[model samples]
Target chain A: MSEYTATVTVRLKAGVHDPEAETTRRALERLGFDLSALRAADQFELDLDAESAESARERATEMTERLLANPTIHDHDIEVEPR
Target chain B: MSEYTATVTVRLKAGVHDPEAETTRRALERLGFDLSALRAADQFELDLDAESAESARERATEMTERLLANPTIHDHDIEVEPR
Candidate 1:
């Protein structure tokens, strides 16, 4: 088994309302930062033992599908690297 | 001016206690997934008009420092690309 780190990034689907992002944008504007749009996401890094990068990605994707992301409202991307 | 997207990733500093990640790791284990360690982070994507990528990255870093991340407990990385 090889040590691998799977990075999963979960974002709200397009056209979905994100109150947190909206609030953050307002806060940034208040701080005199100029931005047209902002979006927020959650990222998870999982370190585990797997046979290959593909296997690590598969497990991470499964984790995202089952627990990390809401299928109806979220879109996630996963990347795996040897550690 | 050109359209750019600044991606900022914020993670807890090493040795910082993260209850959320701990909870998530346990949940994954309950679901029969094997993971030795897990860490969670927040990612922000900002879309803006800027003269150059460096300027966009600078603004994003400032945003991270002032609002997106807590300098006392979090470490952050910023990336910028043309949109």
Candidate 2:
């Protein structure tokens, strides 16, 4: 098995309520910061020992779909790299 | 002033406690997947109206330093684009 690292990014689906982003925008505007648009996303990095790159990708995708992400309201992208 | 978009990426300091990233890594390992390295980060997209790119960047940087990030425990990179 080889060492691998995975970076996963997760974000709220468009149309979802993003109170934190909204609040930040409003605060900036109040401070005369000329705010226009705002969005928020999360990223995760993982270290893994996998038999192969392809196998790691498959496992990461499955983990994302089943555990790491809320499929009903979030979207995620995964990138795996050999460590 | 012109409309602009700012994409900000925030990440934990190298030694900070990252329970979420750690938990996710463990989950991946439990599933019989090879695990290597893991990191966690956040992304923020902001829209702004500013007299110029330089001014906007300055304001955004200040905002990031004062509110959007905890400088002691997080580091951030910002990208500004015409909207």
Candidate 3:
């Protein structure tokens, strides 16, 4: 069993109400940072047992789709790296 | 100016009070996930302009240290990719 690391990011779909992101954006604005296209996302780091990078990516994808995320209102990106 | 993409992960130092992480972990436990070492983190994606990956990474590191995060209580890892 090789040690593989997976980083998964989950973000609310565009047009979804992201209170956390909004709050952060407003705070930034108050601090004099002006960038309107700000979004909030969640990141997960998983240490998984996998034989190869391909397998790790596939498994991470499955984990996101099956359990870690709500696909209807969220989008995810999975990155796998060897350890 | 190349279109460089950066993903910055900000995590609370271990032993810090992470209310959000705790809440999520409890919810997962209630759903029958028996994992004990669950932590939460934040990810930021930046479109930066630089001549090389090293420069992009350096800029991102500086950004995290200077503005995007509170280094006193948070740790950050920056990843740069081509867009």
Candidate 4:
């Protein structure tokens, strides 16, 4: 089996409240940094044994959809690469 | 001034314990997904008004270094693009 790494990124859906990111933005502003909107995303990297990159990505997608992200509130994307 | 977007990705330094990622990995395994190591990252997207992309990137780097990341435990990267 070939070893691969899958990167899964999750972000809150549009209009979802992102308090942590907002707080972070405010903190930056207080430090004299000027900026506008700030959105935060969660990225997950997974190593797997698979037949091919496609298979690894498939498994990672399943993992993302089922456990790594909340479908109702999060938008997720995945990328696979050889390890 | 022109508008730009800065993407700052924060990841735990190698050897840092990531319990949340571990928990998510275990949960994925229980659901029948096969995988090895899993790492999680925090990504921040910021909008800014700057004289140039270089300036926006500089500010974003400062934000990442000062407030968006904990240097003791995290390593971060920043990307700047026109908005």
Candidate 5:
């Protein structure tokens, strides 16, 4: 087995309310940045041991489903590469 | 001016305590994923208007410095593309 790093990007599903993003946009506007709209996401990077990139991705996907992302309101993508 | 989208990825600086990331890693480990270490970040996407991509990037960078990222403990990257 080899060490690998998995990158998971979790984003709110379309139509989901994102108060943090809204608050961030307001803060930017107050600071004089002309932003019309905004959205936000959570990214998680995990280090693990796996036999191959494909296996690493599989573990990352399962991890996202179980903890890294809330499937009811979030969607996620996983990328794995050798560490 | 044209509409553009800016993607900002904000991550904790090295040595910062990341409780949320720790909790996530614990949850994943509980689910049988053998992770060694983990880090987490917040990503923000903004829609705005600018004269060009360069201008858009400049605005996004300013936003990151002032709002999207906390320079004291966070590092960020900004990417802008025409919408």
Candidate 6:
């Protein structure tokens, strides 16, 4: 087994309401920062043992489907690298 | 002005307490995934008009300093791309 790090990024799907991003945009505008749009996402990094990068990515994808992301409203991507 | 997108990632500084990450690690472990460590971060994507990518990066850096991250306990990185 090789040490691997999987980075999973989860974001609300397009057209989904994102209150946090909206609030952040408003706050930036109030601070005089001009922005047209904003979006927010959560990134999780997991360190684990796996046989290959593909296997690590598969595990990360499973984790995302099981817990990190809500499939009904979220879209996620995963990247894996050897550690 | 050219349109640009700024991506800012904010993470807790090393040695800083991260309750959410700790909880996630435990949850994943219970699910039978063996992991050595886990960490979580917030990523913000901002679309705005700027004269250059440098300006966009500067604005995003300012946003991170002002609202997106707590300097005392968090560290951040910003990337800007022309849109």
Give me the candidate number with maximum TM-score: 1
Residues B1-83 of candidate 5 have per-residue lDDT tens digits of: 99999999999998999998888788777877788899998888889999999998988888788767778999888888888
Chain B structural similarity (TM-score) per candidate? 0.97, 0.89, 0.88, 0.97, 0.94, 0.96
What are the RMSD figures for all models against the true structure? Answer: 0.7, 2.6, 4.0, 1.1, 1.3, 0.8
- RMSD, model 4, all Cα superposed? 1.1
Q: After best superposition, candidate 6 residue B31: deviation in angstroms?
A: 1.3
Residue range A1-83, candidate 1, lDDT tens digits: 99999999999999999999999999999999999999999999999999999999999999999999999999999989999
**Which digits, one per residue and each the tens of the lDDT, describe model 6 over residues B5-78?**
99899999999999999999899889887888999999999998988999888888988898889999998999
Stretches of model 3 off by over 4 angstroms after superposition: B1-7, B14-39, B46-68, B78-83
Candidate 2 lDDT, A1-83, residue by residue in tens: 88887777899999999998898878877876666578889887777778898887887888788777999899999888888
**In lDDT terms, which candidate is top?**
1
Residue A13 of model 4: what lDDT?
99
What share of the reference contacts survives in each candidate?
Answer: 0.97, 0.94, 0.23, 1.00, 0.97, 0.89
Candidate 6: which stretches are off by over 4 Å? none
Give all TM-scores, in the order shown.
Answer: 0.98, 0.81, 0.68, 0.95, 0.94, 0.97
Give the higher-TM-score candidate: 5 or 6. 6
Report the Cα lDDT for residue A77, model 4.
Answer: 90
> Please, what are the lDDT tens digits per residue for candidate 4 over residues B19-75?
998888888888887777889899999999999999999999888888888999999
Ranking by DockQ: 1, 4, 6, 5, 2, 3
Q: Write the per-residue lDDT of candidate 4 for residues A1-33, one digit (tens) a residue.
A: 999999898999999998998888888889998
After aligning candidate 3 to the native by TM-score, how far in Å is the CA of A26 from where it should be? 1.2
Q: What tens digits encode model 3's per-residue C-alpha lDDT throughout B1-83?
A: 57677778899987789887667656655765443244668877766667888987887777677677897899888888887
Candidate 5 has what TM-score? 0.94
Tell me the tens digit of each residue's lDDT in model 6 across A1-83.
99999999999999999998999999989998889999999999999898899989988999889889999999999999999
Candidate 2 chain B worst ten-residue window by lDDT: B28-37
Using DockQ as the measure, the top candidate is 1
